[model samples]
Target chain A: MTAASDAPQVRIDGLQYCNWSREIFREMRQGGLTAVHATVGYHEGFRETVRHLVDWRTRFRDNEDLILLARDSGDIERARATNRTAIFLGLQNPMPIEDDIGLIEMLFDLGIRFMQLTYNNQSLLGCGWMEKEDSGVTRMGREAIAEMNRLGMIIDLSHAGERTALEAISLSQRPVVISHANPRWLCDSNRNVSRTVLQALRQQQGLLGLSLYPLHLPNGSDTTLRQFGEMAAEAAQIMGAEHLGIGSDLCQGQPDSVVRWMREGRWTRQAQAAASFPPQPSWFGSNLDFPKVSEGLRSAGFGEAETSFVLGAAWHRFITVSLPSAV
Target chain B: MTAASDAPQVRIDGLQYCNWSREIFREMRQGGLTAVHATVGYHEGFRETVRHLVDWRTRFRDNEDLILLARDSGDIERARATNRTAIFLGLQNPMPIEDDIGLIEMLFDLGIRFMQLTYNNQSLLGCGWMEKEDSGVTRMGREAIAEMNRLGMIIDLSHAGERTALEAISLSQRPVVISHANPRWLCDSNRNVSRTVLQALRQQQGLLGLSLYPLHLPNGSDTTLRQFGEMAAEAAQIMGAEHLGIGSDLCQGQPDSVVRWMREGRWTRQAQAAASFPPQPSWFGSNLDFPKVSEGLRSAGFGEAETSFVLGAAWHRFITVSLPSAV
Candidate 1:
């Protein structure tokens, strides 16, 4: 093995739910990605959610040379040693559990590491960011938080409402995370986090994974790396530098239907006009653009170690701390 | 209407999970049943459980002359006025909620009244009687009990483990029910309630619906009406006569596959030997056997007023007090 390949790498994309293919696996490898938390559930119930795991099993088998399914931080280290990307499964919503708290462990047993309480609508646990009246964390939500904490499964509040996120952060014994979202000050979208949330998140020592999704950018598809870096710097100022990382929120090859489903999953009958996936920022369209993010962070005044932390080191440490020791 | 028809008939079967058909609906009418708690879920998840409601909707439409779906005490009165049987949907297992405690409200909205915490093995909420070790009510179980109480959904502990049943009774604010189980003193099956559960259930002002399922009978398929009556009298001595009713778990016309599914619901692949439905006792075979139970109770030295309570009045009063007012 080459000396470069022998060195320990800690590069990780905190979150991604791309349309998987051999091509994307190749792109991940080419980008030198050490790990990626892949989304598996949005509006699915237990059985449908299990189907997603089954689908990933085939993908792992088919792309055995490129990726490994990760259960814990050790798997990420193993992926680095084997020169393959470690894939950590996550749910973008609690829909897969479908109101039963028992299914959480079943999903965890299946290798899911991260789970969001909501996905842009009212869920059983809590109101999503898009809900009109945020009811905050619900009775079920409290129970779910306790169970997730006990299991050492990370809680992601990226699409949760303000109060729900705050309540969860306060309630959780372990640090929670905003797996993929930019600051609301950077982009006025409901999907983005608020200054108050960032402060609370920082207090809990949680990580804020800055998003590269065009809609979460200030200038949308036209957002430049310099502007993105400036936003990162501001976020780092609010949430400590160590609590920042890249969660690309990349939807590399998914069609418009997937995005539409994400927005209007069985909640309404009215079809949204012109439904489609927003164009990603030019600098970060696919997995092969990790270098661009690093360059942007450095150009925005991040030190070598700080830039490295934002790129993946922070996520690696957060994940290591969040997961159960035996796992 | 004649005085007989105008009277507020409260002849309710606390539980039944028959292979529902128009013929069965006619039999229920023939039996002069005022209401029936029909089991709609056993090992189903959210969507599949909803499908049961959908099926019941169709059944209601098809048999409008015979049955009406009951949402509350008022609906039972409506069914009595219309000379039809009110069908109150219930879940034999919490599997319908799967792992999401939020689904409890969704099921309630769809007209489910009673939900047991476990079926017959280790569940997320607690242990079933079949489980080797009883872990009692789980974290999710406590949350579920609170939500159920808030929504006015009756908590049923028929098939739960001893500890789980006791924990649920202690935890629930409202009166819980053992919708279908005989006293263990009579049958000695894991499915039967213990003296401890009966005493606790009575203290909470809960009702124990004496079951007519053959397996729960002292002599199984050959159990005589006199024997059944004696068991009810013994149960009444321990539990006040007002805390008893009929929950004949009459699985009329169902194939052996249904029983197999109930016993080994994807929990084991050993494929239980000779899996089949047990034969019903000669005294109670179908919905048309309500009069036989009344006769049995009367022969067992129950006074006319107390016999009426066991026949259905107690269930009516308990259900009226259990359900949410608006519902």
Candidate 2:
């Protein structure tokens, strides 16, 4: 067994869309997290998305000691040195870009580092996981991919369909990422990726952020820490150790309404009955449970170097390579 | 000689980015223009573009008797029957769509019909006329074209570079258009379409709206009505009479700042020394000059059928095919 001193020093959550507050910021600091890819927009348009940014600006100003905006990898390093959690802004859907391709630059200028092409339905760029048919990357989707690649924005394919995710991986000049999802071979769901996608991601030197969302796990809410850790080890075996990282899709403090809003945006009128606030497993309840995951990784036989990589260094390497040097 | 009765009954200026007002609306009525493609955005982003739309909504409500928003070709027919000029909203640049391709559907819902891939500089979609090197239509530009085609939004390539314009014409599933530009064979500026681009446009059944902007005219401010008409006749011979029309590029009542705004958006920091507003040619000034252009077309020996087509019918046919039937 690894000694207590062999524990990961820098922990980074590859993806989290929490209802952020001072309480959550304190939790992150307590959890010893160096940085987090925090989602800012799901189905929000440009104006609404801007409002979210403004809110973040206010949060940064208010919680200067606890959190700072992470625009690039350098900021993540600064956060580590200062003992603050670096919050990197991301968008789960490309709605903020609207139909104008030029807005990609504008959003990049505003400090958005990652953007997904689709959420759970068909977008102008490509098919979502929830779409009836996967048509692959559309003509506009191809253009958006090029622009995103040119601007150094990480293309997140968490909620995309299999064909779209594969095409995006192939089309991007830079390394793309599945910011939050597991392999469908582990748990059968449209939201999870296939083995083909995982193989493609591994081949392309991209990253697969293992999700801890209850619905995405093999045993759902009953999943144990050992099972989750074993799954990670299995994923690492397939995707290689360097490509695996944790992106706990933890919705800390969010209500049922927010879940409904996320599942059914302005695109739909019907209430999504199945997408109610999911009961998170007791072993992994919140940000404070991050250390328990590290413990589980050690139990799964990940060495000191591998545990450190899966905890944070892998994500740090990814941001260093994926993000632009300047904001 | 064609009689006075042979005068164009349905005059439609294919492109204009006028400083729109009640006075301009009255002038459009005086000019006997049945419809116009009025540019709403040049360099504005999504929020600013929405503000412009709001302003137009107010203008339409205030001047209900003089003008109406043209959502489709049917609106144009209704405008002609009602004796009100139909104002079809267009974007001189695709900045309004920002980076979200899904906004294309939203903007279409809001009544935007025509959109240019670029204005006077490099955009996410394609290179503009002023770029040092034209790399052709970008990947995002290709997807944008496909989306525009699927949504029935007319792809306008007025200010795009030669290679970009040619590529757009070839790549578009539907017929594209150069909403305001002269043939470079007649005018030796980069702002004008090259003979190769014009030939491709003609072959692909695309329309070229002849620009009357002084800088685009062969003799600049000294260009005579006869010279302009003769140039049109020469162009008609090359592009065929059916594909030729008048966009005019009339900038009536706009301030010099608006001109500067068009030439230099947020993309550049250096002041545009040569982008100062040029003097309008005396022979062709504002909306009132429509009648004189018709007389010149007659003087150039065009038949009544050809004159009518050049004035409006061609644009009418193009819009009828390019816009969705519902709106």
Candidate 3:
């Protein structure tokens, strides 16, 4: 049960969708995680999304000693002070808002601070990475961005198409985030961020939370700590070290069916043959292994300050400036 | 085509659930209504409530010349300046939020300013007037009141039981409203506001919008404008004159099935035998007849200022203090 109590670094995983349990929460505490952006919606609409919120509400009640729902940066500080992990609710798709633009503010009021313009397919807001044709930001997408900006809700472009991502980066008055994605130059997946988007994000002073999920890594599950460090170094070179953090796309304890639903939610009649979550890199398997990332970053020639920034400080600063006091 | 152009009084109907149309819009204009708190939900859940919002959105788009959605006092002022009525969305029941306290802020963000704690039956929040055993504000209801007070959403108790209404009046940090209820002394109906509740409302500086629904009137369809004025006068005595306004409860152009749904929304196994909307009093059939009520109030010895206050100024003042600007 050794923890990262040796250092006072603030650690935040920008994205995760674990089969949440008390064990996982205890692991988070053990890893010294100050906060984590947990996905609450993928393809679910408003009503289903509400059920997820209720579930989280129950989890908060049950695990009050280990975790607290994070609505703002102050909540993160509070969680840290109380030695608990702060969970920030997010949506990987726009379905939760359905077709109503008013739901944006509604969701924000319910503590949904991050919303991806798309998941892995086309959405009402923008084109997803899997779409054959990228329509950039849709008419509703532009309005959603403006509303998100006004409400101080973070706009995540992790799963969005390049055109859509770039357009959103340009359109948002406030800086946007690609909450859980790596560089296309490395992994070359459609889900990875492009150089153009990276540059735009850098220019707009936005953030890129590098993913640890094997699919987004250069060498899948075999991705070594050295390779991860190298990727971080390259990412830092492209989009200043100040704008990078880890968004471990963790799916701990989840069955393959969850992944299937994620990829094929009522959108298609045809089922995909294989639909299991990819295994994580050995050195960074769970919340308990975050210290290994700090070591990896250090070995990759990052200064202590840069390592801390990439670990969680940047996310803290970004989220503090991003969310309003109350919806 | 002659309208209420002779007077510049701010006229607001505290509650309505009309079968909206351009003709209705024209009548609203003819009435010189500054605003109307229009019911968007009776027993509709979150998704259904959103559909109602979408419907209202379409109406707002189609009839932009006649009405605009009001979010605050400024919107009401804008509607008056533009010679259009401001429509403030509301719920006659707590079904829209389901059992989640979070949905309160969500619906408020969607421009729902007023929400009744119960309809004609027991809800999660409290007991409706139609119920035999009247439970006061439930545990969730207290949390809802705090959240509403924080968000500036108006606590409406028009259809709630006496115990529920009184408990809500005492529990709410902000002023609550009996948005559309007559004096129980006048009508002797459970749906009407009790003298005790009226006194409590006055103590809390709350507003009581007298209902004109025939069932809540002294003689149903035979009730005259003078009788209505006397009710208002007595209500003004029970509550302060500043706390009295008109919530016409005008279900204009709505079918009998609509009333049936309102009275029996999946609540019971037995079907209601009678379900038709009652006849409106002769002098107050539609929005166009608001001036007639004003004349009746004047005839009943209401001073010009008091008449205007009852017409709309009271609701205007009450609502301005009762809603937050953003989510």
- Candidate 1 overall Cα lDDT vs. reference? 0.87
The candidate, 2 or 3, that scores higher on TM-score is 3
Winner by lDDT:
3
Model 3 Cα lDDT, one tens digit per residue, A1-327: 346555456999999999999999999999989999999979999888977887887799899999998999989878988899999999999998988897886677667999999987889999999889998999999999998998899999998998999999999999999988999999988899888899999999999999999999999999999999999999999887789998999999999999999989989988875588877899987999987898878889999889989999999899998887652
User: Model 2, range A238-302, lDDT digits (tens) per residue?
Assistant: 78768888899999999888898899988788887686877898788878988788777888999
**Could you tell which candidate, 1 or 3, scores higher by lDDT?**
3
Instruction: Give the poorly placed runs of model 2, Cα more than 4 Å off.
Output: A1-8, B1-46, B49-327
Q: For model 2, how does the per-residue alpha-carbon lDDT over B1-327 read when each residue is reduced to its tens digit?
A: 575455438788999988888998998999899899999989888788866776787799799999999988889878977889999999999997788676665577567899999998888999999989999999889899998999899999999998899999999999989989998888898999888988999888899899889989989988888888888898898787778889999888888888888877777787787676678889777787787887777888888888888888888888888788861
TM-score of chain A of 3: 0.97
Under the 3 Å rule for N, CA and C atoms, how many clashes does model 3 have? 1
- Report per-prediction Cα RMSD to one decimal: 18.2, 19.9, 6.8
TM-score each candidate: 0.53, 0.54, 0.73
Error of 3 at B70 (Å): 7.3
Which of the two candidates, 2 or 3, achieves a greater DockQ against the reference? 3
Model 1, B255: alpha-carbon shift in Å?
0.9
Ranking by DockQ: 3, 2, 1
Q: Over the stretch A237-326, how does candidate 1's per-residue lDDT look in tens digits? A: 998678999888998899999888887787789886547987787788888997789887887899988987898889989988888754
TM-score of candidate 3 versus the correct structure, residues matched by position: 0.73
Score residue A16 of candidate 3 by CA lDDT.
95
Compute the lDDT of residue A168 as modeled in candidate 3: 95
Where is the poorest 10-residue window by lDDT in model 3 chain A? A1-10
The ten-residue window of minimal lDDT in model 1 chain B covers B101-110
